[model samples]
Target: MESHDRLCRRLALLAGTAVLAVDYRLAPEHPAPAAVDDVMRALEWVASRPKELGQLLPGTGLAGDSAGGLIAYLAACGLAGTPALPDVLFLAYPNADLSLSLQSVSEKGEGWGLSVQDLAFYIAQWVPDASLLGKFSPVEVARAQPLPVRTLLATAGHDPLRDEGKLLAEELARGGTDVEYRPHPDLVHGFLTLDAVSPAARHAGDSLLAAYGSLLSHTAMLRRDRNAPPDAPNGAT
Candidate 1:
């Protein structure tokens, strides 16, 4: 988490947003659902004691990249129907299926810096229990339900998890979720962290931030209207 501080600051500034990053526990020591539990606990603490971390959580949305993306969507699913349900979900190249059996696994799995073998090794360390993979899998959990009001799923051209992300995006949209799918044709996995050296990655990153920020403001307005008194104007400012 400490390693992401600089990127966190960058995201906040570029997106015109305030961030409350969770320093969740890691795998091999703290495995599957531990990160999910940690995030929920963090949210609960802040929600119960808003004054302790005022103005940070506007309840607008959730965003995550890579493995964290999977956890974020799962957490968002858990928050469904609650007031904490994010208005928008932003997932950048999420590791959708833990099984690593997606079609792209063989297509782009080789020479992409992130291979199926590597994924398998990490998944074992994180999950440990083969029987629990389906329980912790977003791809499995998502098939039975719709996502939040809005969902943004981005996929990399050469990422092994690309097809699963694309499939989930389509499924969410078909289920009446307002989905936005962005595919970076030239970029690969972990492009978010490579924006410093790649202009295309930087552009994509900025575009994502702009879209998410805009959605947050729009949703905030709608929420305010919904909570307003009946006497107020239809489009009250």
Candidate 2:
């Protein structure tokens, strides 16, 4: 969690967004659905305690990287139609599909920090059952139903999960959801955490945060315009 704290804080500061990072349980010890359940409960608590949450606005969203991204997507899907549902989703190099059907997995799976073998090992520990993979996959869910919120997907060119994230973005767009896709060709998986150590990763992280900030700001402006009093003068409250 500390590895992600810097990135989360930077994004929150840049976007004027309040972020609540969850310290969910880990795998092999607390397998499938434990982390998901914790996230759902955290969302519920956040939604119910706006005052404690820095008065989060209506456009509050979720952001995660790698496996965390997958959990974020699942939690969002699980809370769909409920007040706890996030208004937007941001995924950074997320393993959107557990099926491992993407070509990139074989192309760039090794030599990178996150390898296909590593992914398999983690998945097996977290979700030992092969049948439940589809149930927890965001790509499968997106193909079956429309994602209810705007989405921003950041993929790395040399990542095994790149294709699946792109596929999920395409599927969401086709379903009429507002989707913004950004691909960082020079980076690899887990760049978000590596940003502190690498200048290139830091630059990519800055760009991602800027885009996210713009989205939130624009959404806030639109909401304000729509809710303004009809008789209010232009440029006046």
Top candidate on lDDT is 2
Clashing residue pairs found in predicted model 1:
none
Q: What is the per-residue lDDT of model 1 for residues 1-237, given as tens digits with 9 covering 90 to 100? A: 766676677678877777779888899999988898877666566556567666553446678889888888888888788766677888899988888887899999989868888888989988999988887778888778777568888999989989988877877877788989999878999888877898998889888878887877778788778877788677877
Superposed on all Cα atoms, model 1 deviates from the true structure by an RMSD in Å of 3.0
Clashing pairs in 2: none
Q: What TM-score does prediction 2 earn?
A: 0.91
TM-score of 1: 0.91
Error of 1 at 50 (Å): 1.5
lDDT of each: 0.82, 0.86
- Model 1 C-alpha lDDT versus the unseen true structure: 0.82
